[model samples]
Target: MTLRSGAVTALLTATLIASTAATAASTPAAPRGEGAGVLRVSTSTPLTTAARLQAAGFDLVESRIGTDLLVVGDAAVRSRLGRMGYRVTVQQTAPTTERPVSTGRTNGIAAAAATFYGGYLTADEYVQHLSDVAAAHPDLAVTRDVGDSWRKTQGLATGNDLVAICLTKLQPGDCQLTPTSTKPRFLLIGAVHARELSATELSNRFVDLLANGYGTDAEVTSLLDSTEVWVVPVGNPDGREIVEQGTTSPYLQRKNANNSLGACAVPPTSSNQHGVDLNRNFTWKWGGTGTSTNPCDQTFRGSSAGSEPETVALSQLMTTLYPDQRGPLATDAAPLTTPGYMLTLHSYANMHVIPWGDTTTKAPNDAGLRSAAFRASYYNGYQTGQPGQILYTVTGSTDDYLYGERGVAASTMEVGPNSGSCTGFTPAYSCQDGFWTANKPAMMYLAKAARAPYQLSLGPTTTSVTAPTTTVTAGTTFTLTATGNDNAYGTSGVGKPTAQTVNAGRYFVDTAPWNGGTAVAMTANDGSWNSTSEVAKATVPTAGLTAGKHQLWVQTRDSSGNWGPATSAFVTVG
Candidate 1:
């Protein structure tokens, strides 16, 4: 969703505001005395300092955090936050959640192409190839460094800055916060593993194909015109160079050029070369299983979390590109676990792995992850499961980190053109089209995942905290009471929903048994507007939908759009 510039900052944006504006006049006015005793206080004070005013001793019934409070029953707390520099309003707090669902988006894109031919360029050519592609499509493409990399790219991309490429047809002028963006930011990264050469080639080819299709192909042209496309062709540029220089034969180099692990580096560079595997260097499931410590071994987690410059650089980019969980720039204060679809390109095994990279156990939301993973992978001609479980467990993977830390849902796809040696990143050009035909759909799948606007979630307070995620049974009715709170519009003065929505009597799952089916989507309404959710499926397990920790959510709708009110929980499976 769009952020509010100038004096105010909105994360959920007015994406859902339109809904509230249209529906406020329609909500049957609350019963005379029902919830009438609740105190209402508004303030412009900072949220953290405003909490003290919400306690019962203070007689604070409902404390609204924002630019100015609309007072309901109490004027004391309002005045308190006000004396403390908060703008309080003594008005009735809305009985229900606001129709302010933010346009939650994923950093992925649909890479469906007409031919679906080819993978990425050579390891050495990965970056250059992307650069070349961007150059070729100057209108739709532009290159920028989101951040920096480690020593490998430090010299090349300027402190390892991400040499990112972006393509968009909408400008800030054309499509703005008014009607809300009909589009979202979609990301597709290739070569998280320096040696996964196919990813780089495939990503490059996808970009070129889209650029070429801008006017020629209908589907390609449509996607390009709709979403903002960003691609990181060579995630590990330095490693790629090493793989390329290692004799005429391309050796697999999964790590970055970080020599932190003294032994991780060795001479013959190609054969069993050393360095922290970039894949294993992320913050998620760090120092977990499926990782090695032989310095020379692959899948080695770095000395500590974020030890690599590459990892650090990417983290910085996330902070800058994405909203910050800290600082004056916080993008998503609530649990952003409602993930957009993501596809990370790897090599060899044709497996689509989901989250919980820390253990052999399935992720909390195994059902949702399983379904989306399978679907995305299926698009690309692959299978989906836990990376280690399906293929082998791994630690410090980028996908895990993105999902675990950033509230993003992502998957790793090991694209193999042929079954043999040619399958690695260096597959013969002859097999490119076959690889394209198989994986192009996966790219589309990710894009589709990203496009979904809303997500069912638990409390906005417990952000990224592990909860149950699984498939529900078909034709079965069940009450899932997992939810969180979010204030779509947050301001620096005295706004922002610091806490996730608490389980309310009328809105809780027990109060409202949501429709449980294969195609159950969700969104949020922050009382002012609403937004739609990503296309999340609530498939029921055949035997029955097992009980486990699950994300709680409410499906909301209004004139403007849909929003989310998801809950998080783990339960017993049947």
Candidate 2:
């Protein structure tokens, strides 16, 4: 379902535009648990003759953009409508959600209630939590829906709708997006499974700490002011309700309450009773590898890519905010998200994962991703590496989708719900702070990601082809024209850089030269924007003709801001 598009014209006759202009034009299902490709489009094309376009089999993209939107419906119908001049983007239909299976020690049943009551923050509560904080500041707090989850059956058991929330710095346009760049977007999601109470607790505390510290903590204040942090405290409300029903027993159902296998696994003590693992249902691998079909296994592949409403809802939300890997949203926007990073909180594992969860192999950008993961790992005191490399080969993981399939920079910070084996639902509250403290570093790391997207693009890109005369006539300017690899508002790329300037990413000419006294040498710079590089040097003449023997030399630099090996040539006197 992954979609791609380009910047396009705006339409006054707008209905809905398809997600992408695939050769086959029609409304598509919400990418469901599949990778992010669905762009919802509605019927109606504007300006162009719909019939004329359709007969040619050309997808008449009537929306402002040429690409598609994640639409929900038959792709052919949507395309035909676009040809008829209806402005369409992807429409919402057939979305999905994932299931969870986290079997860990909780304090005995009697104490479980207190922990859930004190620690867990429901989606509604999350909103209230943020609102209360916003109420306190009013100036700093604002709410926005980055995207909506797939529509689903009313919680069959509790009959309640599911909810996800975003807690970030408010800005113009849609709350789902920031200005392509200028600020990094850090997403912190928790409670993908309802039973894991502490996951939500961590998020609740985060809101308070960040908002309250806008003035006290220098580091915290800087992050709140600059970074756009999205926090979804409770992702699966329906799944959580199931756990609530077993208040005393602490039932162990993993998947959302689809009841795919008999509707209920009363006193869920093993995978033989429950159905699929929601976390394993994402579209990236889409049953390609690491999926369970036994229905009773801990990880079950759904009917198709996105079978659950919960999975569908989250995918649509993520896709809209981030485009596909291929290219940009408009002539000016990034081709895709630069380094879209995310952190999904889980329990019972003292490990941090990178990518390629389906297999044991390493991903292409493992080093870079590892660098970012290390930032959080260092804080959590958790080990760093891939699932195969560290914990075991895990397939159908969200971290894999965020990094590989959907192009997000993501990692898993698995928190222990209980420190010891028997402590299950009733871990001591004293341990709460320790868990919170470990995750705080990772939270801070996420906040930093939102600060300017590492500004992969900064530079003194201006340079002048100059002579070594060491003197320029008065009023002479270099006529500098600056340019670099990364263009803002475009796809997220660290571009190319050297040790020039991490902030400005620039290169310049020496205002002063060797002036015949120093070691026959002149130095030039290469602006390594994001990484490191060497500097370049050229040779000067200690003795030459009477006074005017000029010389020509070539100097070069690399993306790492490294200078090139120098060579020289002779010039004749005037």
Candidate 3:
């Protein structure tokens, strides 16, 4: 499911030649949920290959820059591609069945009308669910119609409105679109590309879980009390309607139904062709590499940046809801001064991708971004990094736009298996439960992180040094004790933090003319310094001590790899 390559090759050759060389394999049901095999074409120029395949109608699943282009396609499509002189291989054969075994929900009798379809919800059902939750838990749940989708604004029969559900202990202006607020905020977007059924489903489940967890679950209760979570369960309603129309087999729809660019030039017929690729319609790096000029291409970049109403609305909402959290340009990282979190969910890739999708050059906040993403991958075990590194360089992507433009700590969660009976653009309903379970912890962690995403807040610190008056005998061993606290490894207020919660911490014995001293970590007499309390003690051996001033410095690192301010004890060993 997680593929990484390190080969280097010519960009031009990799792009033009690798398109046909890319192989699509059928998948067999595997216990690990790798539903089908993937077709891979090795390419150094992943951007070119990915774009070419997208234009050619192949679902460009993934791109391992130095290795190969992994796409999703069937036998007939592979045969056609093979005839085009590209190498073809049966990477994996799919099992006889590729559908989910169960619906994964026990809805009362009333659930039937909304659950008319096999495993997915009707557009109406999605809308009603939000309303129902708002009505039931008015205190903690509220719904806002951010804007109408393109189709809805244009009065198309397939149009559906865009909505967001906010779940927190509600207060005046708690979920309002504002740049400043008391609580840290998190935005979870789902189904930007309507065909990714699981994306929407998982978002829905998250909203329900949060709404239903109030008072009963202490952790959830604490999160709700402190953090504001906004869930856009469905981002592209028009495209979702088109996808819902396919009952026999899931529709292979990738773009919105915004047919303004003319006919659907790729595959699946003219009548079925829809709109721009919402993911590529953002304003940042709008028309760079990894996008298509052809309107029907899966990665179409729209006529102009922010052209689509869905794109416009989402961008506007972000600007209004979150003040610029980072500075401009790729050099700036999310600011610790005003940090917020945003995660846009997609399906089938199983990746936790950070920003700078347009290039591999590290983002200004690279350390913080990577730290947050790496921590998020703890539960699901997905590979985490920028698309340019893990997958392929993309422009105008949702994550890059949010992070690049507003300095928000934004990431994309490519949920579920990359290819399998339980994977693909849309996996079976039964597989929904697994994705939800795996991501539950990941989401909970993000909620906790929203609090101090940029800065590592330290707890009260205490320091002890051997010998009074800053003087000690030259031959005497000197003891230094430091203790601090942080919330990175545990939920801020829900339960007791323990050694298991802390990521890492250290004690440094700083000698005069000290650049940070290189030394072994200090030990705790009673295992004191850990996630729970972050305490450590170091004793400088008399053998290494000289007749000079020395200091003991201690700091604690949070789960995000951010170290809190250092605490120190001064001493002079003479």
Winning candidate number (TM-score): 3
**lDDT (CA) for every model shown?**
0.46, 0.45, 0.65
Candidate 2 regions off by >4 Å? 1-124, 144-152, 155-157, 161-164, 177-182, 261-264, 272-275, 326-337, 417-426, 450-574
Per-residue lDDT of model 3, residues 1-574, tens digit only = 0000112113322432333133222322211111223465656666666656655655577433235666555554555567766675654443223322222224332434344235577556676688779899999988888887887778855566688888899988798877787777889898888778888888889888888988755447657867789888888877775654432344456678787777753223211245888898899989887777777656777899999999988888788778876666566566565567888889866778887888888778775566566655656777777787777777888888878888877888888765556766656678888898889877776766676554533322222323235578888776655554443332211112232234455656653112436645666546644454555666766566777765555655555455643444456777
Error of 1 at 476 (Å): 45
Quote model 3's TM-score. 0.71
lDDT by residue for model 1 (1-574), tens: 1111212113212322442334334542321111121223443342323233322112221112233322222222334445665443324331221122222222322122111113223343344445666677766777766555675454633224457777766455322212133455456788767756677777887777777767644335445555666677777766664444322234345677666566533321221346776776777667666555656544556688778877776655443333322122222222333434456777654656677655556554454455455444434545555643433355677766665555555677767732343543455556667777878755754553454422322212111212234444443544432223233221221111232233221122212233332224432223322221112223223243344332233333222222332222332343
Task: Write the candidate numbers in order of decreasing lDDT.
Answer: 3, 1, 2
- State the weakest 10-residue window (summed lDDT) of model 1: 488-497
Misplaced by over 4 Å in model 3 are 1-39, 42-48, 51-58, 63-66, 74-80, 90-113, 265-272, 456-574
User: Which 10 successive residues of model 3 have the least lDDT summed?
Assistant: 1-10
